[model samples]
Target: MFKEFKNFIMTGNVIDLAVAVILAGAVGLVVNGFVSDIMMPIVGHFAGGLDFADMKIVLDEAVVAADGTVTKPENAVMYGKWVNAIINLITVGFVLFMIVKAYNKTKTPPAPAAPAGPSDNDLLTEIRDLLKK
Candidate 1:
C-alpha cells in the first residue's frame, strides 16, 4: 500500500495536476489584485467616485452606548463587496479566456503524414520486370 501510494504520487499526471493547481492559485491572486487594486479605482473614478467595497445596505444600525461604545450589527447587506467580487470574477474569467484563446491561436496543427513510399517488394518486382524487358 505504501508503494502504491508512492507510485500514485510519482505519476506524471499527478505532478502535472499539482503544477496546474499551483499556477491556477497564482493566477487567481494576480487577477484578484489587478481587479481590486487597479481596475476598481479607475472604475470608481468614473462611477461618481463610488467605492464598491464600501457599498452596503445597513439592515440594522449599530447600537451605541452613552459612553460611545458600539455594538456590532446583527445583519447587513454588503452589496458593494459583492459587486467588487463579481467584477473580479469577470476580469479573471476574461483573462483566462484570452489566455486559452491565444494559446489555441498559436498552436499549429500537426503536418500531414508524408505519402507512403513504394514497398520494397513492389520496387523489386519493378526492377525484375525492367530487367526481363
Candidate 2:
C-alpha cells in the first residue's frame, strides 16, 4: 500500500495536478487583489464613488441600550460584496482566456503530413510513358 501510494504520488498526472492547483491559487490571489485594489477603485470613481463592497440591504437595525451592556448586531444582505465577487470572477476568466489565446499563438502547428504516395493515375501514366518509349 505504501509503495502504491508512493507511485501514485510520483505519477506525472499527480505532479501536474499539484502544479496546476498551486498556480491556480496564486492566480486567484492576483485576480482578487486586482479586483479589490485596482478595478474597484476605478469603477467606484466612474460611478460617482459608488462602493460595491459597502452595498447592503439592512434587514434589522442594531439596538444599543443606554447602559451599553445589551446590543443587537445589524442584519443585512451584503450585495456589494457579491457584486465585487462577480467582477472578480469575470476578470479572472477574461485574463485566463487571454493568456490561453496568447500561448496558443506561440505554439508551432503540427508538421504537414508527408506527401501521399503517388496516386494510381500517376503510376498508370508513368507506365504508359515507359511503354511508349
Candidate 3:
C-alpha cells in the first residue's frame, strides 16, 4: 500500500497537475494585482474618481449609545466590490484567451500523409510485362 501510494505520487500526470495548480495560483495573484492596482485606478479615473469598492447600499444604520460603548455595526450590501470582481474576472478570461490563441498560432501542423502507392492498372501492366519477358 505504501509503495502504491508512492508510485501514485510520483506519476508524471500527478506532478504535472501539481505544477499546474501552483502556476494557476500564481497567475491568479498576478491577475488580481493587475485588476486592483492598475485597471481599477484607470476605471476610477474615467468614472470621475468613483471607487467601485466603496459602492454599497446601507440597509440599517449603526446605533451608538451615550458613552459610545454600546453600538451596532452598519449593515450594507457591497455592490461596488462585486463590480470590481466582475471586471477582474473578465480581464483574466480575456488574457487567458489571448494566451491560448497565441500558443495555437505557434504550434506546427501535423505532417502530411505519404502519397498513395501505384494503382491497380499500373500493377497489372507490370505483371503483364513480366509474363511477356
TM-score of each: 0.79, 0.82, 0.79
- Summarize candidate 3's per-residue lDDT along 71-123 as a digit string, tens digits: 89889999999999999999889888898899999999999999999999999
The best candidate by TM-score is: 2
Which numbered prediction scores highest in lDDT against the true structure?
2
Q: Which ten residues in a row have the lowest lDDT in candidate 3?
A: 61-70
Q: Please provide, for model 1 over 94-128, each residue's C-alpha lDDT reduced to its tens digit, 9 standing for 90 to 100.
A: 99999999999999999999999999999999999
Model 1, residue 29: distance off in Å is 1.0
| Pairs in steric clash, model 2 | none
RMSD per candidate (Å) reads 3.9, 4.1, 3.5
Supply the global lDDT for candidate 3. 0.94
Candidate 1 whole-model C-alpha lDDT, 0 to 1: 0.94
Q: Which regions of candidate 3 are displaced past 4 Å?
A: 67-70, 118-133
Each model's lDDT: 0.94, 0.96, 0.94
* CA lDDT, candidate 3, residue 126: 100
